[model samples]
Target: MTVLDPAMVPPRDARAAFRDGLVTPTAGWSAGWAQANLLALPKDRAYDFLLFAQRNPKACPVLDVTEPGEISASIFDGDLRTDLPAYRVYEHGEQVAEVGDVRDHWRDDLVCFLIGCSFTFEAALLDAGVPVRHLERKSNVPMYRTNRACRPAGTLSGPLVVSMRPVPPELVATAVRVTSRYPAVHGAPVHVGDPAALGVADLGRPDYGDPVEVRPGEIPVFWACGVTPQAAVAASRPPFAIGHAPGHMAITDVRDSAYAVP
Candidate 1:
């Protein structure tokens, strides 16, 4: 893994930390920016996936879609193949490779989808004085695939994947109000207080990301996550799919304010 120079990390460029060799995690970089989860699929499956997102807006809010063979993301002034520090290439449900860029693997028929990311709401939570533990610890927010079934479109269907944060019971309401402003990014809590409600048997053992402590007064708050789409894609096991490695997102030029509700 490439180690990053913290001194050189840019505040807004999503790929800056990766460029500086900061491979640790992105929970804290670019404080108030919107981060995006990516989905690249073969042209043959693009329309189906787009419809899937439309039907499941909370889990797959569409940010942008790219024409086949193009890497430039107009929303972020970025090249999709290089902006994200890491990419996971999956072929038929099996992970084929994890690499820094996808240029070598690029195909003329590939279409890219930029989905809303949870990081976009962290700023609001912080402003409301709700502590985001993962950001404080510089760790990726914990994510899990739950028993909740997503409304299927075509062959895309799977349980929802959620990101969890521990919020003090007293501040739970405030956290909800703050996050609800960004509907484009899996807004608000999907569940709170009980892991069993979401089929999460163990908080310490997550399907993705490291776990953190849930203090005496804290409740485990869960939010709909972009990972849901990836889980759906993985389950379907199309001929090929590519996504950003967890915590590493596609940073768009669009400001978080652009997605916030008044």
Candidate 2:
């Protein structure tokens, strides 16, 4: 079996592949396009989750939102129930299913939110010569739940989640500079060096996604992750919800440059 080079595929084609049952982390997929985190909740809980996102912008930078029962967004025309590489179903905060399609569980009252993903900035990081270890290793970017708590919003609260990338010592500043230009996608490093400060006791064991080698002398830099919403779902335990599996993102039609700052 041959795997497509996601980095070289077009966003629409990438999504089509996903709909066709192709499963892979989207880090380098559709190189110049923005990717988004997926969160679908019932109409009754939408307002609370929206407020949670507003109160925690860094970890939940929303790119687009769908009307209740709508399966597509302006920036994401693909079918929300089947276009992503994978989906997670949660009930009362406990994850109950991880599947490639959600149409079986889709509800008419579900409202979908598309949050900006750091993968939107990885192309920029590579262009600037910063190493993205997960991409190099053909693995998922590691994510951790931090001791830091996000601001609570109307029945929702959880610890902030962060994605980790290892950069060479000399390129740390460059990585920060490039990523800062994309605030819509969790811009800049929220914490760099000493994972202990974030309460990450082990680098090889991540709360979400797979761990990649940090390499000698490379420092692990942390960025606010869109997965924070899923963490919120687990903590707040609303009656029900659906989200994309970590690292398995919805490759949006929007270009990454759309989120870049001057």
Candidate 3:
């Protein structure tokens, strides 16, 4: 048997667990469908944040955005306030609370942005015979904050974030080629061999998510992450912000193939 089951998991099944307060990180579920990283902010700051995403496509590729007071996305048809496994509340650049749902924090003037996530590519990797160490070890994908600075857009600016996976040397090229086809989902590895090039000091202590062992003969591959916007939230210190807890993403109805390039 494989590390993770290859069968497609319906998005609603995962959403139901999240709505019921089962706050599990969404690394292995809802295969084949796309997963999203959510960022909700007040309408007043939406433009700046949108501009920031446009400037840093690799880290913040946008998939959908919701109108003020809207709870569902038109593109995917899921509850923004409750679909994700966990939500985070940030105030003045600091994470203040983590909750199972954000119903109490909902506001009419808030605009929600759904950013592309790296998890969308995991299904493809597993199908192509790539071993995802985290899935094999039943741990969250390790992510690190990089020293690289994303170009500033309006008031948002911060370091890039990356998700790490250990790939066998023989399959590294296949991993890159398969994932490169999906540009909308944090496409391809930004760095393949060394974490130090991105200023990541240690793989064991990630800024977000849990660490998995990198077995010998497997090289760590880093991909640009949707969490990059979280760094901006830390730096800009927006008065009020909400996001999916790292690794706890919103499963979308959209298929992963829809985001893949020719």
By TM-score, the better pick of 1 and 2 is 2
Task: Give each prediction's root-mean-square deviation over alpha carbons.
Answer: 2.6, 1.0, 2.5
Model 1 agreement with the true structure over 73-174: per-residue lDDT tens digits = 767677788778788899987889988888888898998999999888887788889999987777889999999999888978888999999999899999
Candidate no. 2 TM-score: 0.98
Which residues of candidate 2, in runs, are more than 4 Å off?
1-3
lDDT of each: 0.83, 0.94, 0.90
User: Which residue pairs come into collision in candidate 2?
Assistant: none
Where model 1 places Cα greater than 4 Å from the true spot, the runs are 1-14, 17-21
Candidate 2 lDDT: 0.94
- Candidate whose lDDT is highest: 2
List, residue by residue over 96-166, the lDDT tens digit for candidate 2: 99999999999999999999999999999999988788988888999999999999999899999999999
Residue 158 displacement (Å), model 1: 1.1
Model 3 lDDT at residue 214: 87
Q: In model 1, what are the clashing residue pairs, if there are any?
A: 3-21, 4-21, 4-22
lDDT of 3 at 231: 85
